[model samples]
Target: MKVVRFICRILLGLVFIFSGFVKGIDPMGSAIKFGEYFSAFHLSFLGNFSLLFSVLLASAEFIIGIALLLGLRMKIASWAVFLFMSFFTLLTLILALTNPVSDCGCFGDAIKLTNWQTFLKNVILMVPVMVVFLERNKFSVRYKPLGEWVTLGILFTGILLVIRYCYFYLPIMDFLPYRTGTNIPKAMEIPEGAPQDEYKTILYYQKDGVTKEFTLENYPWQDSTWKWVDTKTVLIKKGYQPPIHDFRFTDQEGNDITDLVLYDTRYVFLLISPNVQKANTAGIMQAKSLADLCHGGNCAFYALTASPFSEIRNFTEKNNPGFPFYHADETTLQTMIRSNPGLMLIKDGTIIAKWSYREFPEVERLKNDILGYAVTYYREKRESLTKTILILTLLLTLAVIKILQLNFDRRD
Candidate 1:
């Protein structure tokens, strides 16, 4: 019985550690996963709080894991672990039943488990946690001074804040759909008579005497010397607009204009945001600075929001931000960028660049993107053809070589 309890403790501790570490690496991903749950329930209004909740939940898991591993406060730690596992089991079961999300993201992108799989995994974990809960009174260990708990609490609080700040700026780690996403054109209607398939081709580039391939699945993170290009090859079915679309909104003054389409003569920076009151004030100010830079460069700029005209006007007036505030649908703006204050760059109806409010590049970086040659529209098609040809050629060559070798052996 004692041996069984020891094994259960170790198992529970390891499970918590693995789960917490995976989530810690990408708290933002966890936050987005939580947001998916909230959105499915039509509680998307809670999206703004997802990040905060993610940090707290992740910290709790890490702290509990440490306490469990150290065998400190067995009674409290066991109860906490059991409760946490119980809640997790309920959440996973609910998710599996409703299928609200495709992946539970229990381990973030580090481990992709389907809802049912996660449900089963959690159900199994419940056993150990339950054992610990039942036998906690019998468990004993050297007790640490009360000061240790206080110190740990303070340390965890600081860690949470730092993690939140990092995610708010440059995400320490990206583990979701948008991690190093391909830079594809946005806002174009699909032309008639396009292919229909989910086929993706990788572009192989030769650099520094080595060949490297970049595919939609393994992109952005490549060898330092290798460059990756994502050919946005999509088969357009009937009624399929191009994956990209310009954001059009009405300004506070009631003027109808498209934020990204203006200034076909130069780059246009469209800052997609919720109303100032709805967004973080600091984020708004940072976006305002970027808008000011665009204004100085004779580049067209607009701050798009979904708020009422009067509210936007009053907010702008009070803040004295020198950019035009435009109104768009709340849902549409959110889809364009997950961050509250996001920026998109468009030229000739093509999305040239995009940045979360936290990652808004300096003026010089924006200039570099504008000056670079925009990706050609036909590049995706060309790359797809090239990949198919290369693969077929390799197969044919191998077949011929094998046939020749067989004939020679027969003749001998």
Candidate 2:
């Protein structure tokens, strides 16, 4: 029973910790999904507070997870985790039955799950949750109160700092389809011999002022009494989905410049803002300053937004951002960058780097220190890999310590 309880506690704690970390790292993504939920349930009044709620929920889950693993506050933590799991399990069941939203945003974009799949995941988690609930009262040797509190406090502060940094700057880890080093033109291409669209063709023939429908296999093409009136095609299922769909840029005249921009060999700055009105003017000014440095070099800049062309014209006239404004879908821009006035760098059809409005370097620093064709691929790769390694190491170390302590208590 003790062994079973320990395993269950560890398994459940890991799940909660992983879920919390991923969502905490990209709070904006979680917030956006929460907005989807709010809109779906017609509780749109809570949309503004979605981010705050998401962060707090993630933090609470993580704190409970830490408490469970370290055997700190087991009574309270077990009850909290059990209630959390039970509530979400029921919620996921509802989602599976009703199909209100496609994805439940449980794991954030780090992992995607269909409603049925999510329900199944919750069902599997319920096994360990039940074990924890039953074993909640067990108490033995554990970390000192001061040490446990200090460790938990540090973890809590660490996660908040991570979220804050990612909010102000781009996420330390980019998990989007358009992450750095993705070749734009290539990602948008559909591979040859891929699954084609499935459709059912039905022909409507009018004879004596009466319309009759016929399938391709049964339709009479040579009947003299039947006059063809219309053909209707019903799509049965979607076909191949390219990684980069809905990624077109258009000018005021409704001319697409996707190829022109993607094919540009020189460094190109892409100013992405889903809503121009909401963008920070200071960020736009920073973009302008960076654009000034591009003048004498092989660098170029363009602003892509979802705001109306008229509003864009007015905005540019009022505060010339030093770049031609183009159009993209609002959702696309938001997916491209969570920040209102995020900046992206591309070269020769490849996305090279991305930055939030707050992270762009100063003009002098940009020109002298970093702007000479900064290849961020290597830097981002090394940093992300190192961070992943350290986090995994720390988690493993803590797990080993917990096991040794449990063994000592058993011997005692």
Which candidate number maximizes TM-score?
Answer: 2
Q: Which ten residues in a row have the lowest lDDT in candidate 2?
A: 403-412
Across 1-412, the per-residue lDDT of candidate 1 in tens digits comes to: 8998888888878777767766775676678778888999999899999977888777888778767775666888998998898888898888899988888877867788888999899888888888889999988644344533643464366456546654564344444332333233332435668653455566665567766676667755545666543344543333443544544677566677763455366777777776567676666777766677676765777788888877877877887766777788775676455566777776655455556676565665555555352333124434864786577568645653444344223221
Q: Which TM-score value belongs to model 1? A: 0.54
Report the C-alpha displacement of residue 253, candidate 2, in angstroms: 1.5
Most accurate candidate by lDDT: 2
Can you give the TM-score per candidate against the true fold?
0.54, 0.82
RMSD of each: 22.9, 4.8
Tell me the whole-model lDDT of each prediction, alpha carbons only. Answer: 0.67, 0.80
Tell me the tens digit of each residue's lDDT in model 2 across 346-366: 888888778888877556755
Clashing pairs in 2: none
